[model samples]
Target chain A: MSKAGPPKSHPLFVRITHWINALAMILMIGSGWRIYNASPLFDFTFPREITLGGWLGGALQWHFAAMWLLVINGLVYLIYGLVTGHLRASLLPLSPRTVWADTVAALRLKLDHTTGRYNAVQKLLYLGVLALGVLVVLSGLAVWKPVQLWWLAALMGGYEGARLVHFFCMSGIVAFVIVHLALVFLVPATFLPMITGRAPAPKTNEANE
Target chain B: MKRDKSLIAATLKDIAPDLKRIERRLFLRQSLSLGALTMLSGCDLGSGNAVQGALDAMSKWNDGVQAALFSQTRLAKTYAPSDITPNFPFNAFYTEAEAPVINGKTYKLQLSGKITDKKPWSIADLRTLPQESQITRLICVEGWSAIGHWGGVPLHVFLDRIGADKTAKYVGFKCADKYYSSIDMPTALHPQTILALDYADEPLPTPLGYPLRIRIPTKLGFKNPKFITEIFVTNDYPGGYWEDQGYNWFSGS
Candidate 1:
């Protein structure tokens, strides 16, 4: 590790918001599963053991409570990402060819595990999940207040349609999380930097001296 | 070789505390399990833990927000007659077989509280009022909904006829089925709110509140109490059966 480069691989605000988002996501998803079991759209139900609240009423409490955390923290993250140009700088220039190449490399276990740089695949995933987050929140609002937020419900194709959209968006987020966690475990060095906000400086050819 | 070994040992010793701290933080993050979330929810009502208290406070805050967002002009969507759910599912805290069978002949719609006229009107007397019909959806808190046809006198017209105190905060219902609920004044006066006397153009079925029920499409199904025996206008919060148990009081849709 060299001392010549900037110490933080992730900015202070990014680390803080990331952890809060993680907490909020866990709470929301666990309770939301219990709520879904009340009137399941699909044949299968989420197992009771994995669900947060013991019953539907308790689950509703958790769902409504965690929503504020998710929304406010998400807003802070979005504003910071945009204003600081972190989002643009890290996730931009994502082309289809680059994504295809990265996907192949990732599958073959040949992609570079660069500490501070996002590859095209990573950029696409991050951007896609962010969009899903916004959609999930909007659809949730429509379901929660179909009459008061009639326009939103209409945009989602009405009350029943909004519920379907919300469920699918939640599914998308869960999928992204699975991949995100697997990547972290595969490159364990990345996990520490997310917590400590620093990474070992990238090895330069001249550093061999 | 001996000098290099000593230098490596010294570095390990220096970073031992930082490594331990990272491991501890990672362990804490990994232990964010469902069990921890269950404890945070404090699922048992009346247990006064900080987490439960915070959740309760947030639920109350949401109630206020919903109330503020409610608009007199914003009506629940009405469905075409063909859109009505065939055999709309019956829902209540109790089983359908337990639904009270009221004798429509002897039944009287009782009025109390802030109303100037305390007269009890019978089914025949209610029929004289102008009746309107709408096919509107009834959404339940359990995430299910059904659309049904309901015909009755608009509640505002009834309230006016009874000389109800329009400024009263709540209009509460006491039902023959022992289920009670209340709605805010604005909701009570909503153009679509009705004292429904018929379902599907037939004298209300026994399972569907029979003689009379308050048909409020704007709120959750629980808020629209069936088999209503008394209607009271009051300033006090008359918490409903389900609401007293933890459902948001102002659960406006």
Candidate 2:
């Protein structure tokens, strides 16, 4: 506020975990797709080249290995976000009204990201995916150990149902990745902050890029 | 050692039609772009032996975690007959056409390792042991499940009858098919785990292991090896067919 410029953004914990989570999610989704292709839920299946493991056995190995990272890193990120209040500062205050307005403005290409505060649409997407990330892990546990975690599996509608929910949760994260990448690419200035912890303030005399 | 990308796609489409239900729907996900990822990882697109070793180690680690976390007394849910999968799937390393025809007339299940009664038992003798049946789902590692009424002497009955050493570490099975497997000693004694010889109250079908099978409801299907020809109790480790191939040895689900 004193410098009359865009505030410094993205805590170091957020950036580090973001990149690690990005890596883990990629492997998990890829191998997960390979596993899915082995016995798909319906008539359509994802292409194999896009899948992670080379075969059924290999995919399973990669999936289980990568699972540790996703679970552990995701938990660290969540806890850190909570303790630091970064989640509240950047990702909270989502409501139907704000989300509706933000979504409308976004579709019309009028919503702003340079304000250094997350828009309602960004908050909703991040928070929703955060919640879904927890579901993904829980549902994964349900699928992974249906007997030991019968209560969790029952919450997911049982073993078969948990598999379905896990797949959809993966889809939700994938969709988030797509939208997230698009927005970042379109606004290159925001991308550097995730890596370097802050972006240069917009020059007051200069036209917005 | 090589893969045909299109064939993988075709196989997925083929299996999808067999999916169980309307609530069971499919979805797609994303991965790193192919070229950039390949260059970055240097994981051999072929062989991948080093990566495979690392993953196998990881699998072993997971096996330890699962074994520690496993609950001995819990039972997999029993399903109503109406909930049974319409056509209980026939899963094997080879197709049903390749199922070996073991001559049941002379077929005797051999026993060995830390047991007092080592005499082989005929299929008929197995059927005569105290029998119980339950309709339970056999969930596969490949993400589909099917339920069937499996009836036979509980595995613990067989183990106790043979006087297997109570503190042994593992129970191993040799299959009539080339596929063989083993289970942790505790899982070998689970209440629902059976040396199943009958399906739906009839003698086992050829495709479902005609003479005998091991049905441990708490485990994924692969852990329930079919076409069992020999059983043993061992303090030494007995690595399985798939377990040797990098799957978790204790593949409970």
Candidate 3:
């Protein structure tokens, strides 16, 4: 890769919140699976170890405890991302026309983030994950307090409907994680920017810096 | 995994590695939640950790908020007769095979606490008090739901007839199945909260809270006590079987 200098991709706050959000989501999903096990929608059960707290009682504690973290960190990310114009400037211009092209390009292993901006597919997925995070929180509130947030619960097709929506959002998030990880693995260079807050050191930039 | 309430104060503190680090830092930013809950609800700092106290206290805060928001006039959604699930599942701490089959022939409901009348009433007396029915979904916290027909005397009517102190803080039920529960005074008096005597217009089946039960449609199924043997009104906090075990006490569906 050729570049003038090694540009910073993620800032410290973004990096910290990203990791925190990731950890929180993982804990929430794991414990959420344990909770789902109590009265499963399906027949088979997810293994217990995958869950955070190990059992139903423990799982609930983790679910709720992590929920606070997810909500707080996510809010910071959202407000800072929006206010700083980072999310909009970096991930937008998600033209429907270009999205398909970007998807094709991504499939061909040509999608790159050397410029510190997300491609259409990346933009869509990042935006989607963000939206799903909000949905998870909102739907979670409905489930957590149906009467207090009765309107939200009713809007979500009632209590049971909120659970369904919550599960689907979880699935969406898990899918995003899978794709996100796979993309990072394929373009290993895409990984460091998140962890180190600096883009992969291009050959010329390594010397220049 | 499946222990009793004695573990709540402990479990709430045995923080997962990630949660511990995060909770410590987040506490500074979220102390407002702590402040609001404490100031608004007067949460009792029972023998528990900061997080446990916070979780329990927050749940209490949630109860106050929900109670403030609850409307006695509002009704749970009703369903058509055909919509009543034919195989309305029986769920309890015990399996269906182990559901208690009370001797309805000799069983009498014991009433106590802040009521003028402490007299015990037979199941027959209960059946004759007032008959009403509604078909509604029994939402469970664990992610499944079932629609069933519950028929009973409105709890408020029964409480009124029994000369219950309407301003009491709580109405507790002692179940024959050893599963006791209580509701807030407002919830106890909710129009839809009934002392259920029948299901599907038939005498309440053994599998479905045999002798009598509290059918509170506005609440989760567990909040509706089953196989009730006694009813009492009081200012004391009467925690439910599951409530003592850490489930939110005022869990309104």
Candidate 4:
């Protein structure tokens, strides 16, 4: 990589959207846990007994409200990505030749080395996260309107099934976030673009040199 | 008690300053900090008759207001049986321990309420009343739901037989397995809701609600008391076990 703080990666709009989406997801998870604690699908709950103003209903209301925001914001972001050339450079996999080369390079380094902005692994993770988000939204609708969205409910096998999907989807997102944070600390340069809207743009002739 | 628009507006304006003062002093300024502290310490923000009474009264008023004003907006719509899930799981207070006698045949159905008509109901006695059946989904607050056909005697029919008085605003349902829950009588009497005695065109399975269970369509699955034994009519909303731990009492669809 060039130095530490040189400019290159994210647009200002993209950076703002990314942070907004991240904050919204965190709120969604926290509030969602409180909603879950009402009956507790598994055996987890938000720390309501310890927190001030820990209203479970309020949590659910916030969750549902944030859900709408996440959906709308995510959709807008996706549309922007598609309309712009960001999708190709940022989201999709790199060249086929680069995939295996990067795979070996990344494995040899044991995921410690950085190869370009987003490696194959990051691309794969982004794809999975985006797909899971869609699943969460659909499953959420199945519960929100069991009667109205009977077709979606039926597709998920029914309301309980839809709930199961929603729960698992949430679990996946949480898992992804945990690993993501770990990777962020693991590769500080990776997170620089997110915070500062830029990465160290590699020297064009440095590799040849 | 004069219900005139302008007069009500004038009265509200006259009391607005006093209401504002009390709100600013008690609720807005002092109580907010107190409320935050109480929440931090895991305590109810306000207490006693003045505060609790206000809360309880407001809860009741809200229920009434929702019932009256939102009559046009149905909370949810009923659906076809095709929408039912193939595998619906049974939850909480799953089975009946001792079979109770119903009617005069020594068959016993027990009543476990603090009300006057404290007697065990026989299966036959419960069956004697008019029965209604409907296929509805039991939506759980934990984000799950199950659609199944529920058959039960109208609680109002039983409540009438037991002579539930005007003072009885809430009904407590105690099951054979020690599971107990209370519901507002208005919800109890809702034409669509029922104290289900059967499931899927047969007597309730032991794993499900055996003798009887409450099938409240408008509420969450947890609110439906299974293996019901005792029924009590009280003035206060005693809340279900889960509800006591900070759950939505109404749990509307």
Candidate 5:
């Protein structure tokens, strides 16, 4: 809103954490696909071409390794977002009516997008994906050490059930990513701000103000 | 337009050194992301020795984490007799037809390493020791799991009877099938660790380790060596067949 300052679309910390999160997600999901292929719950398996590890052993190594990065980096992101009020400023104040209206606008290809500010639809997707991320990690721990974390495993409906829950959470994240990437491609100018942390002020001062 | 272009070029030149430093950092990050992308695309770019080495190191670190989290008092879940998997599947590097068939009459459980007693005990001698039984799930690293009833002598009791050096770091096993594995002393001393001799209240079938096996409920299925011919206590790490092939050595389930 201040014309005197640079139009910052993202903070430096947010940019760093976002890219790191992207890397971790790719590693976790790719290796997870390979792990699933080892003993698929469904009849069909994930295609080898889309998997990370060359084999089950290799995949397990990658999955275990990337987990630390994901969890630690995720914690940093959450703490920074909450303590600095970045989370509230960027993504908050959503109602069912706003979401429905936004959804209708999106369907009609008429929704307006502003740099640094998430729309109602984006808010819901981001929050939903964040919740799914937490669940997937808990379910993973339950699967990894069912004996040590018996209570967690039980909460997820035991070892086998935990695996199913983990799988569904992963699916949800992948879906969000697909939609997110598509939106970014549609609004190509949104991509540069994430990298450089700033965007040129829009021609209309009223929108930014 | 020409003046603006020259002005931008002058700014870039002025910060060339800083740009170079930023580029170097970007290179590292980009390589990592690129490696991950290639791995997902099923390219061999991620198979380089550097990536493999990093992954191996991380796996070992995870091993340490899991060991620390393992509690002596925390026991694996036990199931009722009816909960046992019907027709428990036989699993091994070798097929069921190729599984070693040990003769109970001629079998001698050999002991070596740091143990004070190097004497060999026959199958009958093992039977004479106090026996225990439990129904526990055997989770495999491959993601499948099965529950089976196992009966045997507690490994710690056997170690005590054999005068095993409790201070030793590892308890290693040599199987008749040429398979080998080792476990940390803490895991070896876990209450659920047993030298199993029976399955489903009957003598072990040939395909299921015949005369002897280690039924460690705390570890993944591969850690439970079958057709064990020798047991040794030592400070040396005795890696398993699967473990040597990249499976984590301390694959605690």
Candidate 6:
């Protein structure tokens, strides 16, 4: 609404990885639903049956194929994050002043108004999605190799329990995607930095150029 | 400074719409390509003959894949029989007394629903038909497994006798205790699959389906209905109690 601040931007690698993760996640969800639809849950079924290559067989192929994409992309992200210091900076919500101020700023819709790489809420959400990604993979492994990784099944309560958890985790990601897109539209500039790696520079003299 | 704000905002505003357009176009192209593939393959739901053909082709492909991946490893593991659990617990349906109630005196199983003929047959009727048996491991989706010798009638023999409709999507099993389970006809009629009247070579224990139970080798334990009542066919999916909760209805091994 007002000229609140100048722009900053995301790094090129960060943007690239972000977009790749988005694409992989979308494919995973689509095919995952197809697999889930083979035996529709509850009274609910997919609005339309997708026989990608044909029915359950096609859905399995799509799911396994997309699964590899998600696993590989996620590993790359995690490894890159660790090797570089981006992981530390992205994770740390330390300091009461920064955390409280950023929390208040985020709740007040002041995040978009302030000048920073990521607001507190953004950091929290990013962290959450990352954690969920890990859980999704782990729970998936329990389903994939139920006998081999019986311990994982035990941790999740059982094989059926693991499947339920995996299903719910995917559902959660779907829910998150809805809110994420809404947020993207609500703060369109927030999405721009993700793509172009650029934002309005802060009024600080260093950013004046 | 103000110029930069709107410039930045304007630039950023284009990103989402641009990305969304690109993603949608890509998805459309991929969907088109997939549609072409399906058209070439002729994949459709419920077209039983077509579905059977597709399954046959898939089985062939899977066989080749399996051969390449696992055929060389081992044909089958020979167990000492002692290696198997001695007192394999009977995972009962619903509860001990809660199975579907077939007439205790008459003890007839009615074959109805998506069938050419609807007839009620006694347990003696089933025994007169072709019989089969196999010793196999019962893998539960609950994470435990047990090996047991199962003896019963071949489902195809019964299906043939009852005259199953090609369009019958499911074989609905109504048990004595109101417990019900539906299985795809293909899985129901697998050669390895049986409707067991006995377990471990003796008449099945009351807790283990006594006079009748289903022994589905390729799927999880829950699909095996115990203390049989009526078997019907239907195109509509009739989910079992567990399947209704969240477990996969067709939980194949």
| Ten contiguous residues minimizing lDDT sum, candidate 1 chain A | A200-209
Residues A1-209, candidate 1: write the lDDT tens digits.
23575656877888999998998998899888988998997898998667765566667877898899999999999998999898898889899999999999988977776766788889999999999999999999999999989899999998899999999999999999999998777667778788888875555312422
Taking the tens digit of each residue's C-alpha lDDT, what string does model 2 give over B198-242? 898888888889888999888989998888989999989899987
Error of 5 at A88 (Å): 2.4
Those runs of model 4 whose alpha carbons end farther than 4 Å from true positions after fitting are A1-7, A34-59, A93-98, A110-116, A201-209, B1-131, B134-137, B143-149, B152-219, B222-253
Span of 10 residues, lowest total lDDT, candidate 2 chain A: A200-209
Candidate lDDT (C-alpha), each: 0.84, 0.81, 0.77, 0.64, 0.84, 0.64
Q: What TM-score does model 1 achieve against the real structure? A: 0.88
lDDT of 6 by residue, A1-209 (tens): 22454444566778787887786676567657756664554567664334232333344544554566688888988898888877777666555577678888777755554323566666666777888899999998776545435577668965667878888888777778898898767655566568776674444323322
Question: B6-51, model 5: which lDDT tens digit per residue?
Answer: 4466565445435534543343234344366355335466445666
Query: In order, how many clashes per candidate?
Result: 0, 0, 0, 13, 0, 14
Worst 10 residues of 3 chain B by lDDT: B28-37
Worst ten-residue run, lDDT, model 6 chain A? A48-57
Q: What is the interface RMSD of each candidate, in Å?
A: 9.5, 8.4, 8.8, 9.4, 9.0, 11.0
DockQ of each: 0.24, 0.39, 0.13, 0.07, 0.27, 0.03
Task: Tell me the spans in candidate 5 whose CA falls farther than 4 Å from its real position.
Answer: A1-3, A200-209, B1-34, B37-47
Candidate 3 — which residues are off by over 4 angstroms? A1-6, A145-151, A187-192, A204-209, B1-58
Better of 1 and 6 by TM-score: 1
lDDT string, candidate 1, B14-66, tens digits:
45435434533332232234555344554643233556567779989998898
Report the error of model 6 at residue A55, Å. Answer: 2.4
The most accurate candidate by DockQ is 2
Q: Identify the runs in model 2 with alpha carbons over 4 angstroms from their true place.
A: A1-7, A203-208, B1-50
- RMSD to the true structure for each prediction, in A, is 15.1, 6.3, 8.4, 14.1, 14.1, 17.4
Candidate order by DockQ, decreasing, is 2, 5, 1, 3, 4, 6
